[model samples]
Target: MADEVQHLTRAFSGLGGLGVDEPAMVSALARWRGQPEKRSGFRKGFPGFFSSHGEMERCEEEYMLRLAAEFARLKNLVVLWAMHPWERDARLAHHVLHQHHPAAIVVEVACTRSADELLGARRAYQALYHHSLEEDVAYRARDKPYCNLLVGLVSAYRYEGPRVNEEAARAEAEALGAAVKSAAGGKLLAENGDVVRILSTRSKPHLVETLRRYKEIHGRRLEEDLSGRGREETTTLLLEAVLCLTAPAKYFSQVMEVALREGADEHEKDALTRVAVTRSEHDMDEIRAAYEEQFGAKLEDAIAARAHGHYRDALLSLVMGAHHHHQ
Candidate 1:
């Protein structure tokens, strides 16, 4: 059943031969360079933003989809110029291309739902251009902390193409759990780190079963193992993200409430909205409470100030805070 819709779905910095002066794009970069800059709020998980469950409907209309379209068109252009792979300098140049073409980068990231397609577009760009896409990314991402994030996105720890129940996830999780419980506790092999490298697939059923089986075998839970590792925050995030890998709804209450209470502005509200739109498909009641505790305010009240109509109503419906369970 998961096979039906293959979900859809970063960079470095360097300078030189970026071709920032390429045609109409040169003018666009100049304008953006001229505008006042804004920070990436929340890093961007505003505190008290998610709850146990999440809002699910995409409210397709609500998303600025057209922006993504523009990015797609521009990314293709960058790829065209990248035919000759260069070193770090050229990679930074690629992002300069993105910064040069803000719309393209925004659009590409927003519309990109999967790492596979993202990598595909990247490879296509590399194949056409002489340089590897990674170089272009690194070059453009220079100095910005988000650079690592852009690069981190290069590969997926999860599987792609199909949600085949090869039990691949089960085996991997069990192996990881076993390793963690034995002599390998808190020890990651040189090879394992990226989600693309670890569990190997983002497919749902397979992952759930994997975690579940891991618990049965190891006595300790997957979350427990994850939280026990070094880099406490990263560990929590890793576990949470994995849980979200299959059940994004579970964290909605925490994400939304954080946004609304701490949001204090449209940007914050928009951030919460962004989180909710994606998670709405999951349970939301748990999310609401988490929000309340995290932000000391109800998620509904926060959104009430700015939202209206179907998109607003749909989210409210979820946050009505009922613990709706799936049959």
Candidate 2:
């Protein structure tokens, strides 16, 4: 482990020179991709190793800037992939809070992650920015329904056990249906505490059963009911949260489809890199299968047609699990 750390330090040191050794960096990163202990060791040892020169921050900034100038997407991908997962998610949450339609990213992080992972992200957010994620989200989304929904999500710490109450789930499903119905009929969704409470507090298995009961009772999916009305931001956000919690693979595959479409703007296209990098080890195979089933084309083929050069190579490496190799 000590020798591996030293090797990684030396390999990363090359980034401060005139040009980046792309192959060397890729090889080192790939070797450590799935080795969580080694990556944790690298993070702990990096600052200590570089602090002697007092150039750690400068080197990182310069390297990132150079990469941004040449390959903006690659810069984002590399920075996110190299960080500890908690810090990576914290940074992503901070960034997307300032962008348009921040609901998707916020909901993704809140709903898709395990309870401990979400808590870790919140701790990292506080450590990095000196503010809690819930507080920041509340401040940014000052409106009634948006603030309520976003805050509830970030502050949640649901139970992770397999036990679920079918009776309570059925009742909660009715409550949720009533809330949506009231919201549609001119009530403020923020006033519907049942909606936020059930969503933010219920265990995943409980929620899944509730959603199934919702369809059984209401004769339609909750998402379908939400979309049958107009495309209000709050309604859309609610739909996204439900989909993320219930069917993450489908939600992610839909995001990738949008990112890979013709003439996609920078924000839209960035979703590809985000989803690929974050889900690579956890569930990339599920996402890839979902993508092919939904879009009727291979994800790798779509990426090859759209992305170019080393950016393409890095993304493919991640998506295909090539990064797990020692090289």
Candidate 3:
């Protein structure tokens, strides 16, 4: 572990000079891909090896100035991968909160993480930014429905147990159905307190049961009902939250498909890297299966087609398991 940390430190410091050694950095990152403990150790030891503050940020800024735009994506991926997952997510949430239509990213972080993971991210957010995740989210999402929904989600500490009350699930499903029915041609479901409460509070299994009951009771998926109202921002955010919380693999697979599609813009393509980096260790296999089941082609082959050079290599290394070799 000590040798590996030293090797990573050398590889990172070597990123500077006349030109960046992109493969060296990729190789170093690949070594730690599925090894979360080693990655954590490296993050802890990194500062001891380098006197600089924000070494990853400095590397990223240098790459931006010295390398082409495509290389910038690779650098971003490295920076994200190298951080502790908690800090990585907190930073991701912070970065996206400033972007246009950031609800999807916020919803992704708030919904997909496990209870402990979400709590860790919130704690990291407070430690890193000196403010609460919910506080920042509420302030940034100052509009109605979005502010309400996002704040509720970030503030949630959902029950992770297997217990599901059938009566409660059915009643909530009925409330959701009624909310959607009443919301037609007027304010969407995001404005409904019951919708927000049920989504933000229920356990994953409970929500799955509720949504299943919703389909049984309503004769269609809840997303279909929401989509029928058109793609208004609040409705879309609500839809995103539902899909993210209930069907994360499917949600991530859809995100990858759009990101790898032809003529995808930079913002769209960014999702490819984010999903690949974040999910690779956790559930890449499930996401890959979901992608193949949905798109009729392998997720890896699609990534190879869209991404190029070192950027492509890094992404593939992540999507495929990274080799354990160093240098």
| lDDT of model 2 at position 192 | 78
Tens digits of per-residue lDDT, candidate 2, 71-148, equal: 566777888899898998898899987665456798899998999999999999999999999998999888656688
Best lDDT goes to which candidate? 3
Q: Give the TM-score of candidate 3.
A: 0.78
Measured with C-alpha atoms, the lDDT of residue 240 in candidate 3 is 90
Per-residue accuracy of model 3 over 63-120 as CA lDDT, tens digit each: 4353454557778889899999999999889888766545688899999999899999
True lDDT of residue 255, candidate 3: 93
**Higher-scoring candidate on TM-score, 1 or 2:** 2
Q: Give candidate 1 misplaced runs (Cα > 4 Å).
A: 1-154, 157-167, 182-196, 200-202, 230-233, 260-270, 277-327
Candidate with the larger TM-score of 2 and 3? 3
Question: Candidates ranked by lDDT, best first?
Answer: 3, 2, 1
Give the whole-model CA lDDT for all candidates, comma-separated: 0.44, 0.78, 0.80
Give residue 3's error in model 3 in angstroms.
43
Best by TM-score: 3
